[model samples]
Target: MGSELRQAFSVIRKAPELISPAAPTPKEFKKLSDIDDQEGLKFHVPSLFFYKNSPSPALEGKDPVKVIREALSKALVFYYPLAGRLREGDNRKLLVDCNGEGILFTEADANVKLEHFGDEIQVPCPYLDQLLYNVPGSDGTLGCPLLLIQVTRLLCGGFILGLRFIHTICDGFGFMQFLKAVEEMTNGANSPSLTPVWQREILNARDPPRITRIHHEFEPVKNSRDIFLNMNLDDMAHKSFYFGPKEIASLRHQLPFHLQNCSRFELITAWLWRCRTIALEPDPDEIVRLSFTASARGKHYNQLIPPGYYGNAFVYPALCSKADDLCRNPLEYAVELVKKAKAEINEEYVRSVADLMVIRGRPKYTSEGYFIVSDNTRTGFDEVDLGWGKPVFGGIAGALLIISFYLKYQKRDGEIGSMVPICLPLSTMEKFQEEMKKMTEAPM
Candidate 1:
């Protein structure tokens, strides 16, 4: 690293010793979800939580790094898998080693203050290299620890916790649960609000797997790449557009009687899907799909899937259409399509998808016709308060490794509307802005 940049973001300490769980966690053969076994799951998630400066006196006489390390050590007792490493099983699938190996914890000091970037804290996050250790290597995402964390104390007295997690370890939802556990330990909470459950076997495919309803198709597995990773990242821009509860209510009221009162998530996703597709302006005959995820947690999936089940329990369901048709369809039509996609994902469908994935390696997906939208609002960032104060910027915006992707982030109060963050090729951003203004500002 250059001296100048290093000065801007300097590492304080690197603790690489195994921080084993406070106690020995379960050591069993934990089979991962077939979906979790996807080749594309090789990508690691990047996350950041921004806790604002507090007027409280917790850190008045104590060291922030020392306090955080102690809390994390306590939390690790229950979350041992994090302290472990990833290993490949006989079936070529990956599972946690559950050894007492500790997670890589690095404490850093950033030269800049938190407020220097102004309103959105997610932007100007350029010191990602100093935040987390490297996870990728030869033999495909192997030989890497399951979790890595970097705690940076800002000059403004705030701290940023940057996380890098293997996708197979858990989806974004389950990761939040782990963070909450650590936060609880930090607060001296006797027990976690949600206990970790590892029943990946529950989502296993049926014997002699069968495909009941073929809604979405996947390409053969090969080397997977981010949809727009090859593009120039320097020119790409990341931004958030917000809509309020009242404005969202208006949107829900505008839909037809059958569709009226649909969820804020459904409406926002449908609207954004149309806008993005329109901005891309692809061929009329080209097939385009709006990919949305459905969580099976707390639902009766043949076997009960508890809310605290810390694993990948989400099903990938999407609405597909010809680019031409999607562009010409009414807004409500797209909303209806998204609703139907959600309806199709019952217990049988989710289980069937799992079975199908196991039978056929991970479904190979072509990026051209795919537009994925995940709801960050449900990831529950608001609940991750570490006793200092609530987080100013914490959500799924940092989850994707791709430079270009879209997700909805929960904004702080007084910030009107739902915050939708988008990262797209700079060339297309202007057109996207025009289309976005037209849709968001158009008469309801």
Candidate 2:
């Protein structure tokens, strides 16, 4: 394909980094943003954006670094909530003190080019940990800025932006909404089309909070220090597969008559769940779970959650089946289960989850025999024209050791396509490939 792949990417942080607009020591709580009870979620969401060289104003004659820094500063004024610090509140829950402590903004230089990135999607994951900003040993809930950003210039004028936001501050939707605002500032727009929604009151647990509807999907978290602690961590491999319009259309046509018009995300997720469970080959009694996030903006719970409501408005809807049954079930059965999980995201479910979190009081989530899926197909990352035409690669850094990334394909070998990047143990990947072949090669 291109030049020989480099094993490790390199970077050097530019000097004199700024954590803008220093603040006075605060003991009193004048401004506080509370973290909602979402049953379970991590403390931080890490994302990456790799942009190719372009002739836009920000990348034109002026220095991109300086322009970005200035634009971010202006952006902070509008999105003032982001320039806060994570602190503990009542009940040991996390809350943001909107004290304007400012964001940790760093500039760096990379040794790779744009083409080196998109060509092999999964290959770049290991380097992502280096590219993103994470406090080495923080609980990810406290003592870290709500927002941390890194802009790295690459060998061929290409650059990558790293964004890590404390989850309590906002979910993926809110984060992208924030980026859209910053992009406007970079492009000299007066303001964003959607303003940040600050009313967390609607999402607060009921006054006499109780789980009105008992749903078995919300399982108590099983604490595990490391997801792959039992396996040799170093032996794991990250793999990616691309499926074009032809493949997606083919899969769609093969679905049950009732599911013919199912969303692409649901179709692919259902297919992935069946494939993964079969590949693992667990006992009949052993349970397997598929957990994916469902956004609550402009959709379910819309009456309670406004259009610009930029916070953790996502709930992880899960479905579990015996490993044996999951492996043997018709694809349509699993697909229907996925459809049911998607349908459970109404206003009652959202309110009940908040109440359940109150009861659980921050429980740990177990990853054993579980597959967490994230579909970035509509992330609007491709439209973030921050003075650049578009980013070559824009997606989340693998949040966990094992995750399935579903997003629109970035490369151009065929018609507009979709891609799935999954990281698994080497032994498991071998079996996974076998199952993938069996499913994809079967006649539609």
Candidate 3:
């Protein structure tokens, strides 16, 4: 069946073109925030969203590619910076030249229906490259288009939206804000309900750049036996794990009564860290690190970040432990470590990180003994309505070597949970599965 579907699936696309703003925009240079230009965020991230055919009589014969193309131009009027190309300045800092150059856009048609993918479309999608073509010389951090979008019309009238955006420009929430603006344009709105804001200067490093806190996420670690440093990409296997109410209940059962109230993000991060460490079988005394980002917005910080401020306003807090300690400890032990790492992301911590970036030349996150997980359950990817009701599947297209995403998923029986995608060495994948099964099958 897979081979037959593969032979039947073909995406016929027109020559890609640039779609500029419908109206004139400012032609000036806008500097990005310190958090935005970090080494870790200089790459492009790809995502996919599948929309079913709308049954509304008012929208019967519309072409999604054309609709989105026109809406994208209109939306670019407010988000004009995204229409510009990135430029590098002194100290390897990034700034956008608002030249109104526009973004890369493509229109395509697929021979297969959305159902051919699966009843519940998950990550590690096989046709990701076909749906979102990576144009030559377009994936660089400098002198590259900030956003690339593709709209593919399926045989069943359903459409898939593929997106590739440079992470140095915005985070997940900021990208969603821009996408929502396009959806507003498709819905016949003259302007976005929420105005766009690009106040990157607010998160800049201080004059003296004082590093008050120790940021373990960016710490320099010299390990001769680093598992990631010696990994072969060809030997890695990607797998998706679903955790619903039952799975959560079983995992919670393994925890002590006092730690039963841990949030789902903390629980899953701790559990996965333990299982992955066991699978790798690192030295007993080797250090293993788990890193995740925490948002620095909202009233808790006295509104330091204004509403509509779409930039990278998050901090990567990391926790580390000896491999033997992490694998042998109780579930609650790792849970407490996860909680401690998350609790350290306050206003001061964020400022301190900016200082560290400037002090350390914007070093990338620690790669030795490192694992990163991102929680996208509340990112509002699934709620995007582009004249079609909502997407059947909306999130990242696949998993990276060391990074995993926690995406929101709903089962056939209407049970909502998280679908996490993980990539491990082929030799260790079986052991990883065994450890995961042990967690989810614990006695209730």
Encode model 3's per-residue lDDT on 50-99: one tens digit a residue: 98988346556888888889999999999999999989889878899999
Query: Tens digit of lDDT per residue, candidate 2, span 164-265?
Result: 776667777778888888888788876677877767767777778788765544563344123365777677867776667656776786677888988878
Order the candidate numbers by TM-score, best to worst.
3, 2, 1
Indicate whether candidate 1 or candidate 3 has the larger lDDT.
Answer: 3
- In model 1, how large is the Cα lDDT of residue 397? 40
Candidate 2 residue 25 C-alpha distance from true site, Å? 14
- Candidate 1: residue 198 lDDT (0-100): 72
lDDT at position 25, candidate 1: 70
lDDT (0 to 1) per candidate: 0.67, 0.69, 0.88
Spell out the clash pairs found in candidate 2.
Answer: none
- Best prediction by lDDT: 3
Model 3: lDDT of residue 132? 96
Clashing pairs in 3: none
The model with the greater lDDT, 2 or 3, is 3
Q: Candidate 3, which segments miss by more than 4 Å at Cα?
A: 55-57
The local lDDT score (0 to 100) that residue 114 gets in candidate 1 is 70
Q: What tens digits encode model 1's per-residue C-alpha lDDT throughout 1-444? A: 244444555555454444456666767545577767766556677767777677246555455666677777887777777777777887787777777677767777766677654554653355566555453341135566677777888788777777777777788788888888878877777568777777777777888888786646454223432346476667776666666765576567657788887887788888877877787777777677777777776635554576577777777665687778878987798898888888777877777777777777656444655766666566776567776767777654442322222333455454534566677667777887887676545566
TM-score pick, better of 1 and 2: 2
